[model samples]
Target: MAHHFSPIKFDNKGNIRESVFSILRNAILDKKLEPGQRLVERNIAEQLGISRTPVREAIHKLELERLVTHIPRKGVVVTGFTKADIIEILVIRTSLEALICSIAASKIRPRELDRLELLAKQISDEHGKGNLKKSNQLNNKFHEIIYKTAESPRLYDFLNTLHEYITKFTEVAYSKPGRSEEVWLEHNEIIAALRNRDSLGAESAAKRHTENSSKAFLEMAF
Candidate 1:
């Protein structure tokens, strides 16, 4: 379900790309829209109450991102993952996350670490309350702080794409039995490594974290 944005900002017509991107991205990430679904430009425009121009542009952007494909004579459709696709995404994410951790471990400020701790607690609370959506958002925000702290724009962009691919698996994990608690414990360990400024510790923690999820996704998604 699309979470209604309270205090919605529609005044900036220039932000249509960002707005459309966010909406469509969330729809895909949250599985509100399934993979391989046809993306009709006019239907999307009508649904969002906008003109087709922005929707067409957004679809073009999605095509660039590999989340959608423009088929000859068939228009656009969501891109679905194959086993090989899953393997590629997981391997790339494992490498990028290790790099992020290595950078963040040295540069993490005390204040930023404090914020991450808070996010961990919030994710735990949200999971306890059976609010999977909020929990997922908090989880992503926590990792995003670590990613941003690395200060590599290209790495950030790559990680974001990796994140989008892995999210489906994480969503499945978060909803299944006992996975949230296990994920929480690992996340805490990651935060602790960053707090101590242990670069090796951070790298190891991140590698383990990604490895665990990768294994689960491989087994579960297959």
Candidate 2:
């Protein structure tokens, strides 16, 4: 599965498709693309004014990510989760994030902590205003700050995929329950631990945060 970047220009076939891919990915990450929605290529193509070639290719990529699924030529649909999917994702994410946090606490600098504070403040503000998108962006940036602090490229790549799978489900799970405040609070605690260079405390807090999120999501789901 070797592919080139092939810089997508405006007129290129993949342009609209890549555009559509990014939009759809963000939508799903933002919880705008609800689970189990049918993805009709014809409708999507017309909506984005792109030919089917790039759209088809994009769908293939999504399929590989297990984000979208196709059935014997009946077109595609967003993968809907069962309780099992939610549980599995949360478990894996909790472990991975905790590992990252431990590494980060040892290496994160004061300047990096400053950046994390800024993102945390931004997320806290957006949560207060109930701006879900901005809130979610800041929330994501908060984690990205920690993950980037780990300074492991391979870990970053794997975590990015796990992150994509977690974002929408976690957002949907937390948003409805008025849990944004709690979410931000957990984030602030992690930042505090990192700032203090408390490796064990950071790892413990990170695990607790993700585990609590999973519990909240399951509570919402049931």
Candidate 3:
């Protein structure tokens, strides 16, 4: 674990436990902490230069989130997402993203639409150039604009909880052959529907995009 995490420099402003929880959670999500890797509280506390209490609290939170599990003999171990977990998350994402696009069709302003068009073009260009990291960043921004334009704070917060998992799965999906190009076309369909204020069209396009993404991830990841 020492190789995976650096020592934390605690600032006075934030809760130590939350920070530890975030660090450990991200490690699991990012695959730095591989599945089945044991999370020893004392070792983590020593590595982070924090007291055992905070590390214990962080591990408890991770357990609650299902990112880790307490094995009787092995102690706390990382529990990375299983196939069923991925399916569940993607299924939920499909519905939420479709709803967002539908709401955005009515609410998106001209300037935001313009920005989305630019992002779509940039993502396509980046993909053509084989710059996947940059394209993925632009892709995230493209969706962010639509959701923000929808102006539903509660919905936004709900999606926010799944953001990291979505990002991770999307990265895998993009690695599939022709997946990037397919996503660009899907994005344009979404943009066109939004521009026309066609809620049903936008919703249908968004649903198709997410469903395709889920297919790509399952094909590539499994």
After TM-score superposition, the amount by which residue 182's alpha carbon in candidate 3 deviates from its true location, in angstroms, is 1.1
- How do the residues 88-124 of candidate 1 rate in per-residue lDDT, one tens digit apiece? 8788889899889988998999999999999998998
Candidate ordering by lDDT (highest first): 3, 1, 2
Worst 10 residues of 1 by lDDT: 1-10
Per-residue CA lDDT of model 2 for 152-206, tens digit only, reads 8887887887776677766665666568778878988999999999999999999
TM-score of 3: 0.87
Q: Between prediction 2 and prediction 3, which has the larger lDDT?
A: 3
Check candidate 2 and list the clashing pairs: none
Q: Would you list the clashing residue pairs of candidate 1?
A: none
Cα-based RMSD of candidate 2: 6.0
Off by over 4 Å in 3: 1-3, 9-19, 49-58, 72-74
Taking all chains together, each candidate's TM-score versus the true structure is 0.78, 0.74, 0.87
Over 9-65, each residue of candidate 3 has an lDDT whose tens digit, in order, gives 857317888788888888888788988889988888888887899899989978876
